[model samples]
Target: MEQEGEVPHVLIFPFPAQGHVNSMLKLAELLSLSGLRITFLNIHRIHQKLTLHSDILSRFSRFPNFQFRTITDGLTPQNRTLGMFSDLIRRLNSITKPLLTQMLLSGELGPNPTCIILDGLFNFIVDVDAQPKIPVFSFRTISACSFWAYSFVPMLIEDGQLPIKGEEDMDRMIDGVTGMENVLRCRDLPSFCRLKDPSDPALQHGVTQTIQSLKAHSLIFNTFEDLEGPILSCLRRRCPNIYAIGPLHSLLKSRLSGEESSLGSESFNNLWEVDRSCLAETVSQMVNDVMENKRNELMGSVNETAKLAKTSVEEGGSSFRDLERMISDIRFLYRRQREAIH
Candidate 1:
């Protein structure tokens, strides 16, 4: 529990993936802007990569309330770049699970975290016994559409829509997932869903992990209402407490101004070397298509989407309001905890 007049503290734990760290770090920065204490947890390898690739340490250090901590992900340097995510998940559950238990029990990370924003992939953390009973928000790095699609993997398996039969089945329309029945095809499901056997361990593990997302007290996604309203609606039916306050990279910029607003890009957090050999040609062609082509309708669409994105993060917009509500709710959670303790 927080002491009198102490700022609310949030612990942000991201799965050791590029996308997960990028979005969660953005969220951590956003929360830091609200004068909250933020402790960002990173796996040791990813932390080293981020430090090597970016001025992340110097940049974040400017925020007095923000800090980073690293833990071993239970993988040797050799096995760290494991082939499949499911294999990594299995290792993390078996190895890192006890580490998390120790971290929480020690209370040495910081003040008892008023709230915890965990990568949705790590829903297993819910099983850890942390005495203070913190409110955990499952933050998914993917779009609302992807998360919604993932939630229905079990149904897809049961309906015989998965174990996607052959090349012919690639174009097969999928009706197992509600709200996306018409829009989704077999080929559109995530790559892991293309397995030849329904009983594949990897496939089953993915379903189990995605299903476990529901166990979180709330869900946070890096998307805005304008982008995925219908799918967000479907998601809300299952997880009533959700915050779709994102395009976090953009939203953070919209909420800040001047040099203080300077934040790192996705590449800054990337673990692997980026290939820029063909960048010049790619940009040249893209610029030609957008600006020079007489028949290009893409420019108009791009402009329209950009305008919508800007509006969504400005005052009185859906994302801006959602972000405020999310912050307020987290503060409320802290208050409720304090009240219960007293």
Candidate 2:
């Protein structure tokens, strides 16, 4: 437990996927640096992935303010190989809430957490807040545009456009989704939204559960204004309490000392292990094929446009500003909580 006057504790729960876990971990690192006690929670399977890499384990273990914990994924031990999206909704619903409740009640972790930060994908965490005193914040791990696209799923369905029934129907062009023009097809929406069966119980359960959960808390997207100006505008109008903080890698890099930053190249999450020789040869051939295709596509047609398209979010951009804002908000919340208790 922290000293009485120490910083407030915050619990962070990332979606059980490599990309989402990595992004959320970076945010946790930033919060820890800002003098907050952070408990970073992962599903058991993902925790196994991080533990398998000794380098990653040693690095995180060295941080006193940042700790890691895991809860069961509700999969039988033998069925652990199933991918994250396979039966994900059921597993999360079955396990996370009870596990979190037990953890909060145990009083054995760090100081009691002031708030819970959850992955936007698992909006169910918002509904799990039976304790009115502990605030909840939704953390979005994907691009702002992708988050915006997901917000439209229900509207699209109501208008009789989505839940496309067959493979053939997937290729039909979708019209009138705001800010997105000439989307390739309904099939182009994220994989979860393109289910072939409208009556799929798991699909319906996951979608409805996630959408309903969004109504429970404030939202934070891992993106920035400049990178997604139009989409951010749309989300702001739809959800007022939205925060865009993203490209977390940049914010983390800025906080680390030079020596610590040098170690940042170490891989923190590798769900699959590949033999080096075979992987290298395969990757080289794939890169050559991709380069040849890109050359054909570009063919001297406005090189600047292609350059702009290829820009990264971490080049001191919108994600950077949002990180600053998120850290500030967390600090302010912690201060307010302390003042209330006193």
Candidate 3:
């Protein structure tokens, strides 16, 4: 039914979490705009949630070439709950490999995917590399600073500074991370990195698995160059193929026509309930006077830095240039595949 020399197809697998899924979806939209056929995959549970929203489903149905697919997460309909579902995620990660492989080899889904772009969190997917011909790229949905922090886990372990063992040492601070100037207290790092019990295997297992997966492929981080110059420079030296294409929402808004881009206006990645207790207490009259009197200087400096970073990612900025280059690369790959098949 179709002719030869069609666009190269891409399969995108976002880590089942909300942030990862939202970031990857933005990239998928950019790829689709470049004339590539995209098959966006999600865990079955997440897919069901999206489908339930009638407005979202209606918008999704309009993208004919950009299709949605799902693989079982090994989760039952009743298992969904509040807070971090670590056990369920671990089980889902383990089961994804075989299901993904089956989908790739089925042939029923059209030509095998030209490439598989996976979320950094789902490092287990990298293990399914039996089909080596299909290139895989890791999409890390975090700041370069955050990724750089993660990369130090092994060294921290070697130094006995991490994998916090017991209640007695919960307040320890870690020193000598490359980009961060201030000494980081244990609480400042991601919650998973602060596990106190040595018997708890998930924290260590996740760190090890993510590090091993990074070795398998090139990485694309959702951070712009100017915003993360120090960390991005360090990462580029360590991993040559790393691409810093981010603040992706801003980039997409600039490119797409007003109406087309608005589809993602309300899209957000926070699945957890908001905890505003700290803010509420801080704003109360008693604390407000004490805090405001102490130092307005520190607060102003932070705001200034944020504003500077925001301006640098606008049109003609570093992120815009990298995005252009990325689009060019995708177009070139599609052309080459078309030539080969013809």
Reference-based lDDT, each prediction: 0.80, 0.68, 0.69
Worst 10 residues of 2 by lDDT: 305-314
C-alpha lDDT of residue 76 in model 3: 66
Q: Write the per-residue lDDT of candidate 2 for residues 1-342, one digit (tens) a residue.
A: 346447778899988777888888777876776677889888887888777743556666656777888887787666655464556566667777667777787875567778788877776644454766777887777666776666667777788877775666767887767887676377777666667675666466546644653564567776656567788787777666677665456556645644445455534556556445667778879877777967755656546533333343344555555566666676677778878889
**What does the lDDT read for residue 253 in candidate 1?**
80
TM-score computed on alpha carbons, candidate 2: 0.83
lDDT of 3 at 334: 58
Which segments of candidate 1 are over 4 A away from where they belong? 1-5, 82-84, 128-132, 258-267, 272-282, 286-295
Which residue pairs collide, candidate 2?
A: none
lDDT order of candidates, best first? 1, 3, 2
lDDT of 1: 0.80
- Best-matching candidate per TM-score: 1
Ranking 1 against 2 by lDDT, winner: 1
lDDT of 1 by residue, 1-342 (tens): 334447788889998988888888888878888878899999998999988876778768878878899887777767655575666777788877778778877886877888888888777854634444887888888888988888888877787777777676577788867888678987787877888887787777767767777767889988888888999999989999988887788888866654444453332556666677868888888978767765457778888888888888888888899889988888887788778889
